[model samples]
Target: MVRKHERLATAWAAGVAGVVFALLMAAVIVLVRVALPGGADGGDVTTDSGQRSAVRTALALLPFAGIAFLWFMGALREQAGEGEDRFVSTVFLGSGLIFVATLFAAAAAAGSVLGESPQSSDFGRRLTYTLLTTYAMRMAAVFIITTSTIGRRLGVLPRPLVVLGYLSGLALLVMGANVPWSELIFPVWALVLSLNILWGRRPASARPAAPA
Candidate 1:
């Protein structure tokens, strides 16, 4: 019963993290599109007002990610105690830690840029944007791959969902390779995984256990 509740809690955390991630992505996309093109005339673009707003919005979602990470770790610990191998769990934990660390680095970068004057050169602006996008995409790739591996080992997520997770991981890899369309894949994959978390379930208990 406690194990069941733990699974439920992990699923709930993942779902909530998905929602937060979606909102953060929306805000980021809006900020990027609106603030990137005009160079220095991009009022407050490189300053504390606009940059800080975007950074704060993104950072606000990090706690949800952290929650999901903790729940995942708990699940891993439980599985290890239940005699499952530790290799995949270790990978998941390591990759998740790396992903979270990147988020912190990205947040710091945004803060630094925002705290600066708005007179950055166009080349510098583009470089910064590209760096941010690349780092974010890499982090997403690591997270998807690790989570999908965990789902496969745990036997909790459905087969189709696991497949989609792999596909999403591949898409992130392709995006990291600089393909233009890979950007669309991450959010779609996130939405799919989130929905799975929201709706997936384990069998309910009844009167008695079946004979072995």
Candidate 2:
């Protein structure tokens, strides 16, 4: 009984962490976009109190969000367990790491635009957008696709979610850069996955035992 309860508690904790991962990512996106309305080339890189504070808050949330995302990724892999295919797992891991690296790179570049030296704002803006929209989102697409494939093969993810993942992956791959805010699909997908993980779980005692 104690073991069962412990497992339940652990699962709940993981689920909550996954949701937190999604929420934090969304928050960073929202806050940053809101703060940088003029964008990189907009020539409005003002260091006003309101914009600076919002940007600072977003930057502050990023490291923790990245950590939570890593935790979430590991948790998903753990749930997939020994049955996960090697090739797909490798791609999944690689893409996830790339996504994190590029995400941070973009954030850093964007932050530099708001620094005291506004001369490099244009450069920073270009680099940030290119890194985020062009590379990071493609990696995110790969991550989503590979994860969906793994879940499909393992019979873990639902059919509809698998379909959505594939569609979103395609969108990210083909149009992520062209479409504004398309990167958001990644976090949104994570949110759905986390909710599924939370809601689909059943207690061991609640699961029906197989008859001899």
Candidate 3:
């Protein structure tokens, strides 16, 4: 009974954390893109008050998004329990940690513009975009792929979801650097997966009793 309760609690935690992370990440990406209409490859931006404010808001929310992502990752790993394959689990853990670190690094790069010279701002913007689109998203792709693989093996995720995860991962991996706003796919995927977990979770009473 206690184990069942713990599993249920973990599932709820994963769902909530994933949703929070997804929404916050999507909001941050949108705010940043809206503020920098020229995209990452564009020239240095004039420090318009509105754009600065948007960037600031995105930066402010970044840490919370990171925190929620960490919680979500941890909860999902907990769900895997002892049945998880060591190799895939290691890749999953590594990719997620790297993605978070790169994400923070990108955020720090973006934050530099809030108090720096125009030249510094330009450099920061470029660096932020590169880190986010190139490195972070690739890591995210790996994380997604590994997660999908794990889910498939564990039978936790449905076949369609597993396929969607693979497609999302592939898009992030192949087109994230070249295609604008491709990073949004990650949050969307996360949101869908989280919703599935939440909706599919069965009540303790619904489980068949263990052998006496």
lDDT of each: 0.57, 0.81, 0.91
- Cα deviation of 59, candidate 3, in Å: 0.3
lDDT of 2 at 187: 87
Indicate whether candidate 1 or candidate 3 has the larger lDDT.
Answer: 3
The per-prediction tally of clashing pairs is 0, 0, 0
Q: Candidate 1: misplaced stretches above 4 Å?
A: 37-44, 47-84, 116-131, 177-184, 202-212
Q: Which has the greatest TM-score?
A: 3
Query: Which residue segments of model 3 deviate by more than 4 Å?
Result: 202-212
**On residues 53-165, what C-alpha lDDT tens digit does candidate 3 reach at each position?**
99899999999999999999999999999999999999999999999999999999998767658888888888888898999999999999999999999999999999999
> Order of all candidates by lDDT, from best down to worst?
3, 2, 1
Candidate 3 local distance difference test against the native: 0.91
Best candidate, lDDT: 3
| Residue 205 lDDT, candidate 3, scale 0-100 | 79
Query: What are the per-residue Cα lDDT tens digits for candidate 1 across 76-122?
Result: 34433444447755765666566556555654454444445554333
Alpha-carbon RMSD, each predicted model: 5.8, 3.9, 4.0
Candidates 1 and 2: which is better by TM-score? 2
User: How far off is model 2, as Cα RMSD?
Assistant: 3.9
Q: List residue ranges in candidate 2 displaced over 4 A.
A: 1-14, 38-40, 204-212
